[model samples]
Target: MSNERLLIIDDDVALCNLLSDYLGHEGYRVEASHSAEAALQRLADDDVWDLLILDIQMPGASGLELLQQLRPRLRTPVIMLTGRGDEIDRILGLEMGADDYLGKPCNPRELLARVRAVLRRAGPDAVVEPRLFPEQVIERSGLRLDPGLREVSVDGEALELTSAEFNVLAYLMQNAGRVMSKEQLTELVLHRKLTAYDRALDVHVSRVRQKLAPLVGDGVELIKTIRGQGYQFVKGSA
Candidate 1:
């Protein structure tokens, strides 16, 4: 049995208990909190959780608020639970640093898959494309990508990027100057298909751009939108 520890924060008591039981059976050490405040307290006391399953809507303190409070201090991978058809909550959760999201009333099987995928991506065992192993270190413009180490540095300064962002950036850089469609990127980086009206890939790309801007400088587009085509990493633009 796996020893991965997971913390689920939601206001739904029965749901929490159900998940705790179900996820426990899936070989994860699952802990549940019915309130965001209690979750925060638990996090403060012990921040060693492998992953966090957060609900977007909760009583007392919303999930977004808790996320805003947690992100700056923690780098834990988060998978948000959003209401079905609630696009805003899903987008907001992603923007707030959630690693992944699933609509509420989600299938436990799907949730387990997402959980495994996120954990695998975040873990040291994450797989990289074999093509990228030619040198294990790729440099473009002034940015250096070390696939083996899963690190990216700009002008010799390392930038902190989430696993999802790192994977997206790596794919872009690997195919610099080529337009990678949202469908392709979503499948390759997120290990999922691009659903209609899904903004997950866009949000991740936006986050990558946002994080790179401060290090790359303003007005210089490192990743450019292709106007309905997709995104291309600009080459020769430091």
Candidate 2:
């Protein structure tokens, strides 16, 4: 993981130093910023980080805001840190394009797990054994999904998708017409078990739907919500 550079942005200087020491020991090349402004400046100057561990409640330009600002320009994976019981922040963070999130005061071991999971999902090259997909490109209606390239396009125009969104969409399209429950989707795509009151899967699915909507047309739904069950990709709906 020496080559895997990470940035930790938080207002807590002590915590930043602690994580820098710990994560550095864990084989990552880690850097820390005590403020959002400094973090943004660092990113602007050198946007080579493999991942970002961002605290949601920062001094200025909150982590959520920083994420919003960064998404348009950088595709670096982000893992948000939020206060315990701040379900709203967690949800908002994911919706704002965070790859994953962890509650503050969390166990470092768990945080490491999440960081690895997020990185793995971010790209095939990040993990030891890459998840396999069919070699042939899948197309329905006007939308096309190229598994080999991990790219999705509509009428030859590419659609921008976060890593998590791309995985969910790929899985759904791979099993088109099948109703995949939240538990199944969560485990398969997130590499984590579904927990009570967990909305991460839903948020990711919603993002995929939102991205697909613009390309497939407004009223035509390609991914359908099966209330009380899960979600399904409507084959031929494209």
Candidate 3:
């Protein structure tokens, strides 16, 4: 993990120092910023971050705001640090392109676990796994997904998807028409188990649906949520 550089954006100096020390000792090159301005300036100059740990409650330009700007540009996976019960912040963070979120007062061990999971999902190994979705192109509902290239498009027009979003869409499309249970999807796509209050899967699905909406048209239902089961990718077309 020495080659993996991580940036922590939070106003809590103590927390930053704590994580910098812990993660640094864990073999990850880590950096910290106390505000969004500093983070943004640093990002503009050096956009080579492998992962970012952002606190949603920063003093100015909240983590969600900075995330909004990084999406479709940086594509660097982000794991948001949110307050306990800040479900809204967590959801907004995911919708704004966050790969994962953890509550504050977090245990460095658990944060480290999440960091590993998110990094695994965003790294090259995340896409090069051919066993999950074969190396062939999957075409369904006029949507095309090439697992080898890790590219997706609707009627040949490409769609910009985050690493997690791409994996979510790919797995769902590869098994079109089957309802993928939350537990199964989480473990398969997120590389983690589904925990209580973990809305990550649902939010990730929603983002995938949103990105596929404009290209697939208003009537195309590429992904559908099952009432009590999970989610399914319809075998229909646009």
Measured against the true structure, the TM-scores of the candidates, in listed sequence, are 0.55, 0.54, 0.56
| Tens-digit lDDT string for candidate 1 (81-116) | 998899987876775568899998978888999999
Pairs clashing in candidate 2? none
TM-score of 1: 0.55
RMSD per candidate (Å) reads 9.0, 8.4, 8.2
Q: How would you encode candidate 2's per-residue C-alpha lDDT over 1-238 as one tens digit per residue?
A: 5558999999998888888888888898988998889998999899988899999998768888787666523667888999999998887677556878888896788888888788777765643223333356888778788765668998888988865677688778877898989887776565556899999889988888787787778798888999999999887754
Full-model lDDT, candidate 2: 0.79
User: Candidate 3's residue-wise lDDT over 188-231, tens digit each?
Assistant: 56655689999998998999988888887777777889998999
lDDT of 3 at 9: 96
Off by over 4 Å in 2: 124-238
Of the candidates numbered 2 and 3, which has the greater lDDT value? 3
**Candidate 1 residue-wise lDDT at 195:** 96
